[model samples]
Target: MRTGGGTGAGAALVYGTGLAQGLALVCFPAASSILTAPTGYDLSPSRYGLMFAPQVVLAITAAALTPVLARRWTLQRVLVAGLVANLLAMVLLVLSQAPAPSGGAYLLLLAATGALGFGFGSCVSALNTFAAALVPGREDRSVLTLNVLLGLGTALAPMLIAVLLPRWWLLPVGVCVGLVLAIAVAWRVRLDPGPAAGPTAGTPKAVLPGRFWWYAAAVVLYGITETLFGNWSSLYLSGQRGLGVATASAALAAFWACVTVGRVIVAVLPARIPATAVYLLLPVLIVGANVAVSGASTAATAVLAYAAAGLACSAMLPLSISFAGREFPRLGATSAGELIAGYQIGYGVAAFGVAPLMAATGLALSGVYLVGAAVAAVLAAVAAVITRSGRRPDPSVPATPPVTTATRSDVPERP
Candidate 1:
């Protein structure tokens, strides 16, 4: 925070955690893709899909559990646990090799999901908590930067792994290196201590006022847009644009690259703008980008559109997380996890349904983008309304006590 507004302690921890997340996501996604390659493991299309579905479910559930884990265990400890889980998963996957036995693949998949869940859940939770404590009033733009940097890390992993693995056996070998790097980075930092709400820090008893759910839903809706592209932009580019698969992948990479850039920009934006205003802008940006993505006939147009989408979607989560955490401090980490889980669920559902719908109706990828745009628009309106109208209720007392010298006595003293 010497240069930025956040404290150095919080910044270091978040940045390191971001690195770890990047490494984990990068390694997991890239390493697993080779599973179904006939020349490699020869898994069936359906089987490959099944193998990965568990990963998503487990990861999403684990992410949602972050708040509970954080309350029970400090953020750093949880992350350490996650790292250990990641190491174990990698070992099992490496050892379970050769012809893919149904038992072995699923075992490895479960282990991997556990590992990912641990790493993702703990780090995301800890970092958000740490950030809230450190950055007092400076949440919005700063979080955007974190999101961008993290996206860059995620996006860069596949390309790097692709380059490393072309020589055959070196692919899985690189995964070990990544896992170690992720662990090392996570080890170097510490989470800023969470709020001193004492017993209610992160509990079912943790109060979630109406305002909290409002922000959570906003994040959920916005998140669907982000995850949709992340999961399928390459396929859309390849199939719809008639670009070679490699070329389409490059487009997807560009999307991530722009996401990072957009996050950086938003992070530096002026504080004069209200959160409501920023939230409202998200839908507008998303619609424009999605339209570009679907309607573009040329590769250049595709890249530009998807990249804009990445950039536009970048700040949506950061803004929502910041708003939710501060607006409902008691539910800070829990809401963060909830919103993230919502996003993942939306992603999973959309991924399964959208592609098939397009295939069946002969609707172009444009149709998919159009639908996503509509969703984004609805989310924007809701966020604006919530930001403008909803007020966080006092969780400490069922009713606001009559103001008097004695009423002040019940207010919890700040740590």
Candidate 2:
């Protein structure tokens, strides 16, 4: 397949997906800090946890099933449908909350949250998966650069929301903006219209074997760290440590600012250092931050800790996903979605659900932090072992064998 020039729009969509995922990932992470039991939002702990729970499961199911679904619908069409649904859900939730939120209001919140989660979830998984497959080289710049874009979104979403919410309450506004972008680009842009766009396997493609499960586990473990810090940062500072909401919000924003920096730094030399080194570095840096948080005698220490930990974890997930995804092109969107599910489950277990049960350790926040460090340690060891002994197959991205008619990618699928 010959191509037309779209270096600009293609780049924007990639950046935009980063924005959408950043917002989707942080949508609840942002609100959970502000909308808790004390805030009188009437959204129970169980309800807040429930908002992410079903969405994670459905995202995994959607990621895997998206290939089949895409056979009939264009990827853009699917994205547009989900975006519209998400916008509706956000508007409904905002209206329900204004005059005084209720139990019924919480239900509406969850339903809308699920729609947005799945839409963002599916679009991200599809685009990233396809990018990995379609790139001309296995370890290509575009595929790797996506980590930077993703980091940009994740880091920016919280800070942007935190900064803007004070003036315009931009949750509704951000969703509206994203809906327009998704609609505009989904029509104007096309991402390599070929078999490279989706999964070709009927069932259980054997190229990756079972090693991808390790990748899934690594992400879930990594997510625990992110959840503990992201969902509970404000609470830890304000509720436990006796800081003002304004001070805590600044700490959280600073953390993401550091994350954006960390990703760009690590991205520069990703191929030089081994994956295991990045894995090992994360927990070590996080433990150092945890020490500061535990002994945050003043506001300055807390802010420093948040920033350091953000940089620590900034690149962990994208690195793991790239390493794990190298062999499993057939899984495509589903694999990405499943890993995200793993991420949410681990995050939910620590932040909203389990941490509350261990009430002794300052709502079990410290204990969860310790547990997350331990999980990261285990993943480093697991990654070391897998690097040495996993199913080794040729991972070369298929060459564009002279395009006569069907295109190089359509040649009976090479693994």
Candidate 3:
């Protein structure tokens, strides 16, 4: 398990990549004003929602491709490629802000977001896998820490946007410059190219294990709840709840800040504190918070409710991936990628599918919070089932042993 001198550098690189991912992700929701402004794209809510569809679709594709790509490339190489994509995405986004021909702006924006999705998906898959591999037995804590950095980036985006937009292009431009610096940092960091030590190492890869599907389903629900609130809360606060633009931005920032803070709390908790307890308890809190958001009459009430919802939902995604990695250590990256794909599917459904439903049914923005609550309730039941089923190890699978000397060649090939 010794990683030599590169462990510290690798860890820093992973966290830095996470910070960049968070900053990039927040741009979409944070830039909602410019994206839908009459002077800008003048996009309808449905159209704005549609813009996310490409990102989701491309992200799912990138995630699915990560494991396949990793077989031929070093994990660091894969990460670098993703970062390059992110830089391209940022540049494209900046360009989309320029005056363009009729309908060209929308097309350019979609292309930019699609690139962003590809970059985020690939980078996240690689970083999560790299972090898990760096600390063999502490996958949960490592993943949580990485995601905490990402949440910090997400939190910063809104505050930056509130101050910078009408000139939102600066956000992406800043991200692009950051990516350039991050890519350089990543190149200098050396990652341990070792096979993950686990009981299932030599076993034949099973075809989509039952437990993985359960985890995937749980993340789907998690994605729906998380993205629905993150993307829509600003609009809800401003348009429906009568908050000013800056106030709505502040609310969004508060929500992401809570998410970052909540993850930090979980990361430091005793390792013996079962993740199942968190999985189960968080959904109940999320359901309550969503209900609160639904009934919120003032900006203050809505901000508190959304922040609470962020706190409740913060650990669900990372924890689900951590659980899967622990259960199937040998397939750590592949399993994580699958779970991410499942998450993106849910995100797409919630982000894009919900908008038209709202348009048709005359559901207020808060009504979507109720829908998220229902999904979260289902996620809770799934978590309970996971808890019960995970009580004992499968007899068919053995516990993974600690890895001895392993090279890049020792890494398992794609199943």
Candidate 4:
């Protein structure tokens, strides 16, 4: 598979993936209203939750399978397939909006979400690899920039829903059409493919370093904390906090907006500021934000707290991935794909595990943000341990030599 490509094409591809992810992420919250409007299917909460299960499961499956698939398909092909899957998902969603047989609508919605998950998982793995390769030594900026596009997509979803719902049930269909056009544009852009998977002395196929697992653990926690807010915050605001539907949606938008804004801030910071310092500070801020969100007596306070949480949580995943890439320089793409899989695992847990707890606890769900905050604390501790230990390498594990373009033809050209 070809790996190098023009920087312009690579950026376009990455940004497209981000927008696809954003649109897919909003499906859950948007569905809450989309499935209940006068012309809609009126799905129950259990049924709505069931629709998400397949998306998360299938997405995890797709992400786990990417490394294997990359062995045969070009990275560009894999990305194109992902975009095609997203297109199919959007078509399914549009069909779901049309009048359908009694139970078929729910099934259509399920298929749409599942396809979306597959698309998202595939694109996420591919794009992160591409981003890491794009800037070479400055992976933090590339990853952050990529995620900022993603955050923009996520932030736009709720705002679109707020503006177009009820009267414009078909607005998402139009959005999907735009996405399909964007995908077509991306398809025409030639780019580098993923690196081949092979065992090398510098990058062993057998044993991974211990610190890799530490990074994975942090990613898992980051997923839990981020998903807790992204997935549940709307329900918490409307159902528990007694905010109006539009207001709650706005708050959700606020959370993602702050996330996007925070990424921009992190991206521009002086490289002299250690990433570890940023990592250490975020968890404390996240914990405090969660505390404020849980105790918030008014909608305004809760919205502000959720936004604060977004800012606090923004840099964790991208920076963690960047750190892992630096630590395992020889296996940058592989390490990224693996850590992302770890992230999806955590996402699956949060989606499946937390919802039931919320249902069982009812009003007590308001306190669930604390659990996320606590997880963030664990993540902070893990980062600290990794930082202290990373100064000295273990004798048992051999240090891998850094990868070079001559060594791997598939590594993309630096922008």
Q: Name the best candidate (by TM-score).
A: 3
> In order, how many clashes per candidate?
0, 2, 3, 3
Model 3, 223-278: lDDT tens digits are 88888777777678888888777667666777889999999988887655766677
Could you give candidate 4's per-residue lDDT for residues 80-189 as a string of tens digits? 77778887887888777555535888888888888888887787777776776665556677778888888888787766766775655455676577667767766676
C-alpha-based local distance difference test score of model 1: 0.63
In candidate 4, position 373 carries an lDDT of 73
**Candidate that scores best on lDDT:** 3
Could you tell me which residue pairs clash in candidate 1? none
- Candidate models: Cα lDDT each: 0.63, 0.60, 0.76, 0.71
Ranking by lDDT: 3, 4, 1, 2
lDDT tens readout by residue for model 1, 203-318: 45465566567666776677667766776676677776787667677677777887788777766655554456656787789978877777877877877777788788877776
In model 2, what are the clashing residue pairs, if there are any? Answer: 63-334, 64-334
Per-model TM-score, in order, reads 0.83, 0.79, 0.88, 0.87
Error of 3 at 39 (Å): 3.2
RMSD of each: 5.9, 5.6, 5.1, 4.7
